[model samples]
Target: MRNAGLGSWPHRRARMAPKREAFSYDGVSTTYEEVAVRTTKLARRLEELGVRPGDRVSYLGANHPSFAETMFATHQLGAIFVPLNFRLSPAEINYQLADCGARVLIHAPSHQVEHERAISLDSYEDWLAGGSEEPLDVPVTIDEPALILYTSGTTGRPKGAVLSHANLLWNTFNLMIGVDVTTDDIALVAAPLFHVAALTQTLLPTFIKGGHSVITPRWDVDECLNLIEGYGVTWMFGVSTMYADLAASPRWPTADLSALRVLLCGGASVPDAVIHTYQERGLVFCQGYGLTETAPGATFLEAADSVRKAGSAGTPVFFTDVRLADTGEIEVQGPNVTPGYWNDPVATAAAFTEDGWFRTGDIGRLDDGHLYVVDRLKDMFISGGENVYPAEVENAITDHPDVAEVAVVGVPDERWGEVGRAFVRPRAGAAVDAAGLREFLLPRLAKYKIPVHVEVVTELPRTGSGKVLKPALRRLPLAPAVSPENAPGR
Candidate 1:
């Protein structure tokens, strides 16, 4: 196989296994050769449409085989690929498309009505139907931008992080150094391609190894389990919430999960219980941490340390540097670090330090070289002059047997300035109330760290990648604050 480099993945795959199955979805299979051929044609079609080097080609769709094809095609033309989160509102999507100045927008047939303002690649299927099966020769520099993935932007408008071809290529190599993947391996890609976690961490790595990718349009627990069992899937990656749901499902133990080898969980703090549950089932579960700015992967929990370093995001991946500011913010610098936010120099300058470290905005600490994420610096709050980190509080609450999921936020309080409030989702078939949960947390957390108000909810708002939308929680109404006379320890 040839060396890994920018615009070299498809070429490498074609040489490694031209006729081998590269992707499968809904009973449709595309070989490495076919993918290469289609992508080449798509690139020509894009060029005919006036897409030039540095132009952005945006895509809004669920996980599908075409999504991968479009990504490779965009790279084939030296065009930037911008993937929009399907979960975002139309207005939010419009803002991103306009912000990126995308010349062409490719979307799923289902989203055609919602995104009709731009040209659709699906509509031009016939144009791409027949073209040169030969590969389109395009030159790409290592420093050239390959993709633009928007941050979740829980606090403000999302920023477009420009990931260079070298950024992604090196990050994939970093992942391969840690995780052993082979051509015989089959990866289950249930997460959305819009996020770097799914794109760079899972899909790109699988492609680099000449492995097969099994894509699911969306996350349906039963469907995911069925596909894993039927396709003999060997690897999978998902958010902590997805892992918790799969572990808690009644069908999990009975399903043929024996084929599954590695399960990666990230995007949020993972509960210890979820890790233990998967361990009991003989599945190896590892935690990973990264941001869009870092090409999505900076650290990974090694299999040897999976249990010993439970709840930790582990050490930085190869070629990545991690440091903590005096204020406790985690700063990262490495090849995988993004060049900058596209067309937003002011925000881009603000995201980095004078020394060139990218401010992750996440507060964490390193213990003996292992990274432990505490909470987002923006999520930290002050109540009555006391500092509180929500992750610390949420961890304590989720440890409770009855609590299935929990999110902590600061709510307005007249006397204390701001107080902690928790929104909890109880375990299935478990009876839990505010008082019981509060009592359960009292001994586990400090007085100020414990939530004063608890609300039972069916579900919590989350981003496409399953991260808790704390900003949405902040907008929700909080219960009336307790009077000074009745407040605890007042």
Candidate 2:
């Protein structure tokens, strides 16, 4: 009596607001009715391409209307959607495609030459011309796999986190209630749709409410401002770094961002300065925390707490149950949590406890039910038997006016088992000296927690998701103590 597959959401949405604008990009708008109709034709075309129920349909392209359309179409046939990051190398993309044993590949025209297995998004018209627009009567249920989103896997080889239709739906509901998404909301999908946050938090919830969404191939501050003013975007989600970049934009002050009611910040802990900047513009920057395994909506610092609990990731979402493990690693139990990695039982078993609670790998604590994220357990270091969390060190280091970005890593030391090394990126037109930074941190953090060695870099290497790659940082040679700040900016 119940149809839980995500494929049915668009059909249901069309009934509520057929003529409503469902999506827009690069001046083209598609209504709910149009999406419903086109998705069926696209589904039929995919069927013709031999994608069957439970088979994987991969998309390797930048954000586009066709990407969303293809996703829903795959859902229509009870197939799983695999959206590859366009920024990844072809080898990386091909690894996922083959790992999932994808039935077919749909990619942007520009990437088609690099991936011969993929059919260009431009060829959709020709492919669908002869296909029938019949709705598939597949037996896909809410508990079945809906998507296979690969984690950044800085800790190990990238593993596909299998998210079910139920996981996606539950997460959407959790965010809608926690984030206060409304039917009139126009959400901007600025982050890569391949990630769960931009899709589950922004796109899915808005779709269910018959709201509007704008997709972009990449994140651009100027174009984002244009969309906010032009489309009347009421909500958006970005990493703390992205928010800082926008605050630095020349047009940010006068950009008519009055329509933006909620700004969701995640991926990393936002600095107090970035929060204050948006508050000046009359907006509440909601900070959140989650992983791909949790469908990405585990916690959200409410608008009211944006200032009150500036550094916290906030309370757990409605359905998520969060607790601290004996070792301080965050553990979560919820319907939104992923079942496990695809086809890797050993890894899956290792991810959860015997009682089935998923270990988050990141060390954190709860204060009155509000979660405060510490650094990753693997990234934590022991200096002469004392625990050193990198996040705490980074927070203290960035407090200096000259510091722009910073990453702390633990390296092997002969005296101590491991020691902290600080890499600082100075703000533009600003200068920071190791001697000055050492004096600055002396007051902010415990002497033992301070990095033994300090170095300056123009920029820190980051993953596509905006995570600092500590592994890459570890590869750089470290000096005995203070290395003079690299004054030359890249």
Candidate 3:
């Protein structure tokens, strides 16, 4: 309660609840007392490496107890913590490090990253074991950049979002009300912890509330389901696709999921059907909407409203402001919003409005104070001068019984300038074809919004957070351009 600095939480909790389990990973569990002690030791070791305040300390690894320890250690010395996405290729990972000017790099045992400043997990512990287990008293304010998370960069080069201690603390306040966190809550962090959604939205809040967190190195449907039953995980966050896969699990029907209170989802809008799948099992799907720049916790749909107001991202949380620009782009202004991108003044200027509103780049509409996301502004295309949002078209296409998952992208057209192409992934045992899907969408969507081409595929390329990789999908070769005029029965 003294301050919401990342380094202070474990120390405070250790005094209040020393024996309480903080985070459980693989087969090992760390108590609040243990976490505070471990982070203190690591902080001293980092100082021995000449890490100073304002320097960047980057961590690249899977979900391990050491990730949290590294975060606390970096912030304790007022150094910036940079968590690299393990899913990124070595080149991409190296690009982020060079861009941030990281001085120290830490990786998991399994990875063999050959950087002059890099240290493996074993070496990290060896250093920690030898260092003094005393807290470092460095000058740190709430406004200091505590963490830097590089964006996925679906469009251009990746930019590092500079999240300050204040930003993260405010995000936890939003999450506490968003998910109703409590001391008894045990969150199963199945998603990649490097992402803001999983770390700030779930794990950080749980830690602050003196609750327990269970980590999975990677998401395996079976392992996640087992943890929910085995550990009695009360809350967890994942994307819509993860939920879809969970519902499709063979043990889903029989799994004892009564212990779960909230099943949080974001990254992309949850399909209406996917929401129903969890609802049928007595689970609440709290779909959220936000960006990494906003410390990633903004709006969250309530459990009760999940069904009645199916596709809405709900209202803004406490201390957050969500408004629309003249162009209908969602603009946010709040303490949770990052001060700016790391070392990029030009990009930072363009990210905000003249009056300081952070441009979210996402297009959405507010209905009765609730937010309904349309699609990304960049993803929207013009067909014969009419605007087409792929999400609107994709929703109609998903109504077909056979279509399981779908990604709609705008392809170049000679007649309309730009037209939509449907990439369909059929349900497990169902069959799908182009003409049939087009006919199914005709009545549900406007004729102009109807896709000119529909190609059935086994799967759509997706990000670690479950967003469809539209940039990658656009690079794929289509079978043949099937115009509306070429409709099978036309």
| Best-performing candidate as measured by lDDT | 3
lDDT of 2 by residue, 1-490 (tens): 1446888877889988999999998989999998988888888888888888899999877788888888899998899999987655455566778788988889887774344346787876787667686766677889999999976443425689999999998999889888788789999998878878888888999999999999888878899999999988899987665687789999987888888899997766666877888888789889898888999888888888887887789998999888889899998899999999999888899999999999888889888778998767667665533346677678778889999999999886544445788889999999988878877766455466667778888999999999999999999887777632321110
lDDT of 3 by residue, 237-355 (tens): 88765777788899988999989999888777666877888888778888888888999877878877877877889889889999998899999999999999898888889899999
Q: Give the TM-score of candidate 3.
A: 0.79
Lowest summed lDDT window (length 10), candidate 3: 481-490
Ranking by lDDT: 3, 2, 1
Clash pairs detected, candidate 2: none
lDDT of 3: 0.82
Q: Give TM-scores for every candidate, taking all chains together and pairing residue i with residue i.
A: 0.77, 0.79, 0.79
Residue 324, model 2: Cα distance from true site in angstroms:
0.1
lDDT of 1: 0.79
For model 2, give the 10-residue run with minimal summed lDDT. Answer: 481-490
